[model samples]
Target: MRPPCHAVLPVIACALGALFHATQAAAALKPAQLAIVINDADPDSVAMGEYYRKRRGIPATNVVHVSIPGKPRSIGVAQFRLLKQAIDSKLGPSIQAVLMVWTAPYAVQCNAITAAYTLGYDARQCAHTCAAGQPSAYFNSASKRPYTDHGLRPSMLLPTALPPIAGPPASLAPEQARQGAQALVERGVAAGARSLPASAYYLATSEVARNSRAGFFPPAGHLPAHRLTIRRMTADVLEGAHDVLVYQTGMAQVAKLETLAFVPGALADHLTSHGGDLLGSSQMSSLRWLAAGATASYGTVSEPCNHWQKFPNSAVLLRRYLGGDSAIEAYWKSVAWPAQGLFIGEPLAAPYAVASN
Candidate 1:
């Protein structure tokens, strides 16, 4: 009972094996084009920001530091406006993409922080949860210089992937989460430029509402030209896969994620009302994909009401990824209405790029 296609990033691998090795080719999103935002209040944010900045070779001028006394889950529009102003004031002209380090504050009102920063805060989206939000000019576009072409800089969050608030206890939770974010950065660097022999799994679950985008899954087959394979399955879950590049499904909480291994620069997420509610108690958060080894993942901060346009179109996502777009670019272009969706992961992982690095 799925309708048609459509629809939107922290992340780059799972096990790091022969299935996906280091790449050497080209990347579209260069280090100089990226800007890193660090929250001085949160220690993890500061540490991961420093590490990712160094690893990616981001220019010193492309860094912005802000202080939020309390790292709340969602900030008020007034506060976000100031935050956005602070960030915008510091970014240089060459900056095209932004990486906000930290898991909390992923949303502003109902709009995801990433969308709010890149597209400007839209109060209309917060006015209605299920209504259509603003359309992105960059959706499915071929523009490489988003900032220069459209005055928008696509943003992604470097999240810890740890279950928010109530989850299993850990002795060194902050340190461990910081390490997790760093590992994600490493995977992104390793994914730079490589021809990956991978598979994209599209699991069609019985959750009819959640499966609205299932029809848009890439035709299940092999593409020898790209050295990629797409699998459209009728099951609710996949098991024992060694090379998972792109995984899209619809469920409140997915099962058996730990059993699979994801290739570097992987994209994985579920479609649901609150998957983007990273700190909310109910339903699984999109951060689980990162913990499960996915490099980038997406989830809606507010209820999207199963609108296909609000989620990432698997067809466009795979096409952009195979066409050599970075994880952030491909993910951002796939979502037409993304004000409510949070894009999380490593933003610059481009495993398929053929350009000179």
Candidate 2:
């Protein structure tokens, strides 16, 4: 026989209380520690820069502008060094994170733009290409400022939809790009009040090689009360889910994407080849998630990084976010090997930073 409803109330209350207490101890990253980098040569970059500065209230001194040709998806090592030097000279040493407001030149040869800025461009980091690079100092750290804490600064790209013909599109016609960028700020602000309806996580168990990441999924019953609800699925794909906060899976292409409804501050990513190569059309690009309404996403820039450790750990990503880290910080910390990974999205969204009522 089952216990009466009244008898179960105490146990439920205890679980909720424990969750509330854990959330209360979390910490958040400050906006002042972030710097905005704009590619002045690109019109779309300039427009997005202005919009982000106004939306995030970033100080004028913290905004650094550099001139680089808009064509060619990659830049030479020397060119990247000069660009990095200009940024360092302009922003000083106080800033710990950067938001690059352009999509072109996402790579500096073999290195992703985000990795180049954060760890500095070095052939050694990409010597093996598929092999892991040096581990990040910012990974799983509790420091408020990365510069002071780890001597390493992390960065994220505020991606723009590429023009159909390789030239800049009508400046005003880029409203779709602005929608995703604006959503990040709006969602971060909204997170401070009400939590999303529910949070869903998907784990695919069909393919043995791709299923390596499934072990990290947290038990559903252990999740926080009324804040996030987790569901673990063994199917190869998940569909028709609503109000998704965090979605992780692995596949060459994820079908039925329209069936999932993402909350404004949601974070979603798939472990797949070329998902990080936003310029490629062969596989589903990570940018599609942003277009589909997710605030942030990640993917590998090159071929065949089958190492599960090279990707983001589902549990670490969720726990860090729930502990009040911003999307960038939590995402950076979740990945053990980020040298080849491209992190693109709104860096400052923090849904779990809100206080419980």
Candidate 3:
């Protein structure tokens, strides 16, 4: 997902909701020591920072909301340096994560700073521009590579959630989709033979496109789940990999969430005033597809789904991916009337299997 700082940055204000809405025995991250860097003086961003901290139990002081004044979308190298200087002055090395929440001031510029944070690069060493197709491509002049997806960093010890790509496929026609899929297959084959963890890719189908009311299952015409289609395709292309996985997240359920999505006040301001589609609810089907069966997530940005009424489907898929015992049970639990009594896991874990003699 894009970092909080970008031409159209989408930060994880509600990601904290996903991260720590409930308590479990598993280890959880402390929200304190996390700094939220905002450039625009948008009260919504500030309110979000406060909403999450207080409502979610994030330590108040941990949320630092900074405003950059009169800064253009493209901050020249000089202005970039000054912005960095200001951030570094107040930045305590103890800060765990940085959320750049500016959408109007410039998302690409925001990416410049946040990229530095993710890469473990010295904030001062951040450059001014990133090349096309490069991670920091849309970032302002003082940008830096924030690892593969520009915002996601690979954890040395744990498996990271791979991001899923959203938006229109490179090819819209069946033939183009076939060709594109074939190319990706070839690339995976090469990467797998080299013994590297393969890049995972998934797609979401629109409701009208598939003519389905539900959102979790792919229609008959589309590619199936990881085991049947994706993994099979990967095997066909590449040799010698036991752990790599290729999969397709379902689309039927996602459409439900899309129908329910409403742009929040803060992001609405960005889109209306600044002329960009920065704020709105994520497609439920899209989020499920992203979270399916991955230890972590990466890819195009999707809005947080915790607050939505139609989010139980998302929770079910998340539970399934995160270790919900069974998708059916997870769905039932999430949809049960008491709503507040549901005991979904905090860090949804993979389901534990029963041993047979």
Candidate 4:
């Protein structure tokens, strides 16, 4: 038997409101809770670490340096285990998340670096890289400190994708790379002041399979009239949308990206396979959103189980962020199967975080 639509609305609203208030009371994770990992062998990684540390005011002791080489793109499980042990030993138990500053070695076998760190190096997590492995402990909880509440931590990658700059090094010039990385942190700080308006665009595509999660999008009229604007589109993509704070849709690849504008601290992502496979050629990379100026984004490194339930729910993400959760926290909470998804961008970008404080 199914409940009537009207009867379900209040229950849903109540649940969301309770989640919002509970999370509102919790503080966003601080820079002190993060342990920054830098690959000493890569100058670009080192520069990024330095820049992020200075910009976020991270403590010197919290920076952990490792000698992982910058090639091969993936490391052996045993090698990654050792690195994890080293990080755990150096940072102790106080750390709640890790910020890996290098672009290379993003995967440990089939597990993304962020996934491996947060959930540990389990071959099961790798066995089905496309499928959902496990639910994250930090999802939708009132706990600000992941280690304290869930006994599991969360992680994110900085400089997920580098800008195109011709250089002897060829990947990204050190200064240019640092600027790109620092932009994320700066935007997060700026979001604290509400310098930009709160808005969201939910593109409900005509593709039936892709739009399976469209039912989860919030009603446009229900959003706070003054602080936020919600737009629901029945097209493939929205055009000329400016200062977009949150944009979500499902498609193989997003089109007309150049015409869309993203404000600093904006959260944008499209549900698609292989978007999280940062270096793969199969589909559009999740890094495109970062390149387009969004502060944070999410995508699956592999197939992601192909069920709408396994993917992020737009309503949960928007409500959590509107209620003061950090970008990483809100995004993490919205997904039922996060083990396969790689959350990339500024972990601490919290536009609504200011209101709570």
Candidate 5:
């Protein structure tokens, strides 16, 4: 028995625990199907693009070159529209996923640029930060080709600056960004095409408001087929885990991350209002997950009022990832309403691709 779904909107909250039992073999995303967008003006972006292209063997045709002013952290709708047009026109018809290379301009108006690009600009998100912004077609869907099947591209950010530089000279920022990006790309490329044995941590934090995602946590056990162990516990911060694959918890400021070790192609994130503010978020930035050795993470750019729909639903994400969907697919599919959230990481990381039935 399930609640009635709205005619125009899909039912988001449903019992789909059985979804984890089956893998979507058709949902495997390939490197050629992904398009990497680079800001030619930004040398760091260009350098990271080339490095990722070579490492992932992404075709030159799939590399998109655009010239956009990379200064503002959030650009107006007008400027974003123009920039999106330039990149969209060249994406052609086969690109299913997009990788944006740059740090600034992660948000357009109030919506995350990654969400705005895939779902189109949501004027409503800017109008009310706490209101339901926009419904996504790819949310929890079994669609393999988001662009071809759903007519919408799924995008993630491969920022030039992953673990952002703090108290560093302006001249050293680009070099440091290049090194960080190179490390991120290497981690992603190394996490895939095989079965992996890893642990998924779901912590019930003391912050009641931030723990909206607690209900969505999957049971704690070992699924030998996928080589995954799901663990549920009540703790504020995780410590001394050597094989961390999924670390999803709610906290304004996550502490003691250095105490744990994250596996390659790992997915980790904290639930908070400003985690998506990549540059100067008051809370811990999503970038910290990457710095802590996780391959991908998500965070909301604006105030979302702790709506579970605005954050990644762990059940859906775990199912999709175990089902052979890439990092971008699983992360993007988990969020019911993603207009306010930002997806950042290597889009192609799929450590469990070989385990799917």
Candidate 6:
């Protein structure tokens, strides 16, 4: 006989571990029938989901992992077929979000066809194109250098008179990484020390939210590329909800250093079109809003992630400003790396709030 669903319950429980926390008193998050489509069986994605499920006390059954066709590196038509099948089988009207892990050619296809056309997170591709077949930067220094047909490479710091760059190289020596970091700090300071953008800050927050204990810091350079991805993904997700809150956290110094780049005007415009507001909350220091878009209201939250032991109380101010859940802080603290003292967690809890909206 096939194993009963409850048989897997223990395994799921073990996998979930310290991550799950129960929510009884607060307003319930409207369930979003979320569907997670993965490129392959990766430890990172699996660990990430487990963290979210247990941290939020979402039932094990609520998180489904669907495997795609093809090798882990290449996401071609076969991979697309599996992804489409997974979505067609599981996605219903109640589903609010679909997160795809890893980059694939089909990822662009899926985002364009499903996220853009079907989910209404549409976008116009920018014309500032990199040369075709120039080569891919699987691993290169933060310098804004052209690429060649190199298979895989190490990261190196370029000389001055160049923009800084960042991102983990597939295989970078420690000395190389150190030099790169130094170069980035110098170049970043010289560039009038511009802040990246609200979206970039949000992405950093997500990484912090997901793996704060991992000691992950944004690489020295590559701020523009980071900003582009964060803006696109957050904008897409926010468009589907009536209100979305993003929490940006860092060391007081780094947070202060990057504050100038959080462009409220650009993010506000994106938010306003979706009938949403973009609020930045920090735990360490303050973030200055450089600009505001026409439709959305842009501002900051005063607290940081470590104070979440007081989640119920801090959220009082958040509800006053954005009008969402109070229990979210409690829920986040129970499961997340609260000791790390990163960003706020309301936006992470937004799915629960904006479900009916």
Cα lDDT computed for each candidate against the true fold? 0.81, 0.71, 0.27, 0.71, 0.83, 0.25
What is the full ranking by TM-score, best candidate first?
5, 1, 4, 2, 3, 6
Q: Tens digits of per-residue lDDT for model 5 on 6-113?
A: 342343335555645665444378888999999888887888899899999999999999877645789889988888898888988888889998877789878999
Candidate 6 on 21-77: residue-level lDDT in tens? 212223323323333443345443454445444443444544556654432322334
lDDT leaderboard ranking: 5, 1, 2, 4, 3, 6
Compute each candidate's TM-score over C-alphas: 0.90, 0.85, 0.34, 0.86, 0.92, 0.31
Comparison by lDDT, 1 against 2, better one: 1
Clashing pairs in 2: none
Best by lDDT: 5
lDDT by residue for model 1 over 173-220, one digit each (tens)?
666766677777777877765456889999889887898887677676
RMSD of 6: 22.2
The TM-score measured for candidate 2 stands at 0.85
TM-score of 5: 0.92
Cα lDDT tens digits, model 2, 161-190, are: 522222223333566556655665566555
Off by over 4 Å in 6: 1-32, 38-40, 69-78, 91-94, 101-106, 109-347, 351-357
In model 5, which runs have C-alpha deviations exceeding 4 angstroms?
1-13, 24-27, 164-174, 193-196, 355-357
lDDT of 3 by residue, 279-328 (tens): 22333212222222222121111121221121232322332222312211
Lowest-lDDT window of 10 residues in candidate 3? 263-272
Query: How much RMSD separates candidate 4 from the native structure?
Result: 4.3
